[model samples]
Target: MSRYQEMAVFAAVAQAGSLAAAARQLDLSAATVMRSVAALEARLNTSLLLRSPRGVALSPAGETFAASCQQVLQAVLDAERSVLGLHSDPAGQLTLSAPLLMTPQVLLPITLAYLDTFPEVQVVSQARDGMPRLLEDGIDIALVVGPLPDSSGFAIPVGTVRPILCGSPAYLARHGRPATPDDLRQHRTVAWTSAGYVTAWRFCHGQAVQWFKPTPVLSCTTQQAAIRAAVAGLGLTRCLNHEVHRELQDGLLETVLDDFAPERLPVHLIYREGRRATVRVRTFLDFAVPRLRTHPALNG
Candidate 1:
């Protein structure tokens, strides 16, 4: 068994908890993964993994080896990337993840344009509505909105989006428009709970911050679902300015309480620490950030 190949396979399995997930990620068969793991264990003269009915767990030996393998494997990739002619040209697959709503609002357009510019690079997009650990999930880069939890990683604040209080014209007609944070309490509201709290909506004018807890008429796991419910006139909903920019422009929805809009929520492009900032990733950020700021709806 090739030592480097074994290291790569072990690292893949460690990153992906299941053999099936590792196989799919590596574009290999489950049998191949099993064989590689077996070969590695034999060469090391230690059982690295404990297989059971539930799933595979790394033994103490495996835990020590996995971290070393990741470091070694990353060094190898870095060396190869440095020498590879296409490395400077950014010719490789880039895996990205973001919230479901941001997929259409921000990432999709940038990805489309990126593909057009770098035909040699393939972009794979994953929708992770809930916060995802970039390294654990094997995501090359992640676009995160709102504040992030404590983690060891690199974050680039590319831009920000302001939340807009909006609803379909029909819904506003029925529930009445909220002119201030206090008015939201009497209005039917669509709540998006997957990202964070549903009942609390914050608004600010100058230094004063006021929060409102609306009577949620509908709740959904995703921002997209909340926006959809609002579009269908189920209830008033709030979302990032970019999420409903086109809809508002096309007269599908209308914004209310713009004067009392909340502070700009941060948008970030984050990646694991020490992952080489590839030329492709840098290029996309350079192009996308400036354009995103100019977008009429987003508040930079």
Candidate 2:
């Protein structure tokens, strides 16, 4: 294999922390990653990685060489992107990630439009539930639904979503509407157990936030089930406002305690690699940002 390919393989191994993990990231076999590293080390006349049954760690030389490889590869990529041609159309593959529920309704339309606009570009998007390791997973960009983590990467504000409380009209008619957080105790609840058994739900009133623990009649592992229970008049439930849009529009659910709701969750387009981002990555970000910022469902 070429020195360029070998260096790229070694760099992937160093970043991923294991040959198997690196192979998975690169879509190569474990044996191929091992061979690349071995060949690179033989050519350099020094061991780069310390091998083990559990995983691999960089040797002292490997650490230094790994840094150089990253810099060199990045520089090469940047140069290639810049030198492709002055009039050359943007053409490359981009991998993206978005929240699971938002993909179909929110991101799908934008993606299809982008494909129509840029026929030379290929796209692969994964519906992810939480923040993904961007570099390790080779994700070019992600649409994050909550507060952005510190130094996660560059972010462009999109909009916000509220954690809303809702119940069927029938359920509300029987249980009475909860005007305050304390009234949650007098009602049946359907709890989403994705984050474990949720005993308490938090709400904001005036300028203060408080938690109200309600006894749940049903505990569901997925949000869809919890929402379904609420729609069937089983009990009240809490979920993001956009998640229940169709149900609310259809009169299957009605939001309660809006005055007690906290500040809406902020959304953003987050991407790593900053200035080193490829032409396809940069092009997609530019194309996607304005459209995302104006999304009605995502922003309050």
Candidate 3:
């Protein structure tokens, strides 16, 4: 006689088009389905269904009530999911993706910490240079750098990185540091190429607009290779601050033209549509956002 059970049975009967079929669907005796519907009709003081030899059909009242029932049922299930997400320690494999250079510096540490804290969750991380369609590709979360193009997805601002010019001490000692953007033309530079945009750098220096195209003595397709060449004093290069943080700390690299540093590169954590966020993903964001906010390697 419970209203919930009555409504559920009514919905099943309406959907299945017959008491026998509805009983089969609910795995209950046909008598049970009949009594539930009867109780429901009595409680409402209206006949909600029409019984015929051919099949079952909804009465005028039943037709209207069934639509309402579907909405109510969906709301109840959504509420349950919301509460479960808030209370439960989520367990499942979380798949994440990020650009190749960004993966090591930004995503890796957060992932390591997440695993240590949440032993129940497993991570599958992929490094790629381009963003994938989360719904189509089945990615749970992604770390993206720079300004994002307009699209449908949920995103939270995590951090920022500044693109700056850096060179080895030995290289600077031999060629001298570029005091101004104009000096870049005299230096042997390492070019990092990606996405078909090459030979352009943007900077600002005390009311002066400057752009430079370095004559490439060495060109690299990967950030690691570019950093390696710069570390070996092959040429001056431009890179995000975090990419050379360790090298800078170890005195393997020094930043030049600081006054002309480009605008901070924005970082974002994006997720797929209708994706139920688990505790593992939530916990990592909580811990990671704070650290990223204060880290000197990133722009505040």
Candidate 4:
């Protein structure tokens, strides 16, 4: 097999965690997939995967090699897309990543519109609550909310979202709306947690910021789940304005302590810096930026 094919198979196997799974994904037999990975290891003169009946686990070196393979494969794909851009109509697959809650509320609409406008383009979107490594995840673009740390991507500001503390009308009527950030202590809360620990709820008053680490009556990993919990009259939950915009509009939820809400979080469409923009990416960005900036939820 060609070096590129070998690397591609290796990367596929690593991602799939089993030879049979990778074979299924790549439309090859399990033995062929195993042999390709084994050949790659022999050529490198090092053990890459620790094979077991359950699946294969990448060794430390294999982990680094897989990352490199992904980058190389991505570069090849970019080159192909650039060449294809010479055509009149853009036609290619575009992968995107964004927060889980924002996907349905915001990104999905934009994607559907883009698809309708560009018949030849296909979209593969992944939504997760945690930050995704764009390169590692093969994401062409990422819709990120809140402050961003130092990165090599070009962040284009599309809009802004403010965190809102809200709960169902029934929940608020029973527990009473929190008059201040500290007043949240006395109310039941639906909290978002990461790694089994609840994250602190942050609020602002003028120039001062405060945090409340409430013992949640219900804890969830996804913003959508917490919002649902709050809407079910379980307790108050904190979420981005856009996440609960529909519920708020439908009177299923009501905001509390709006005066103490923090400054709006900047929303950004981030892509790798110094990379050639594929026609699909450029077209989608041109179509999406303005719509997102003027979106009702973000504006309100």
All candidates' lDDT scores?
Answer: 0.79, 0.85, 0.79, 0.85
Per-residue C-alpha lDDT of model 2 across residues 74-150, encoded as one tens digit per residue: 66865775676632466666788998777875788899998898898888899887777776566779988887778
Q: How many clashes would you count in candidate 1?
A: 1
lDDT of 1 by residue, 103-193 (tens): 8866788789878988877887998765777666657688888887778277777677888889999988887888778877787889888
Better by TM-score, candidate 3 or 2: 2
C-alpha TM-score for every candidate: 0.75, 0.74, 0.67, 0.78
Q: Write model 4 residue lDDT over 1-300, tens digit each, in one string.
A: 999999999989888887889999999998898889889989999999987777679998888889779768866876775576644466777888888778888889989999999989899899865566777677778899878878738788888899889999999888888899888889999987767998788888888999998999998987778889999999998888989878988999999999999889888898874346766778888888899899887788
In candidate 1, position 233 carries an lDDT of: 92
Supply every candidate's count of residue pairs whose N, Cα or C atoms clash at under 3 angstroms. 1, 0, 0, 0
Model 3, poorest ten-residue lDDT window? 272-281
Question: How well does candidate 2 match the true structure, expressed as C-alpha RMSD?
Answer: 5.9
Best by TM-score: 4
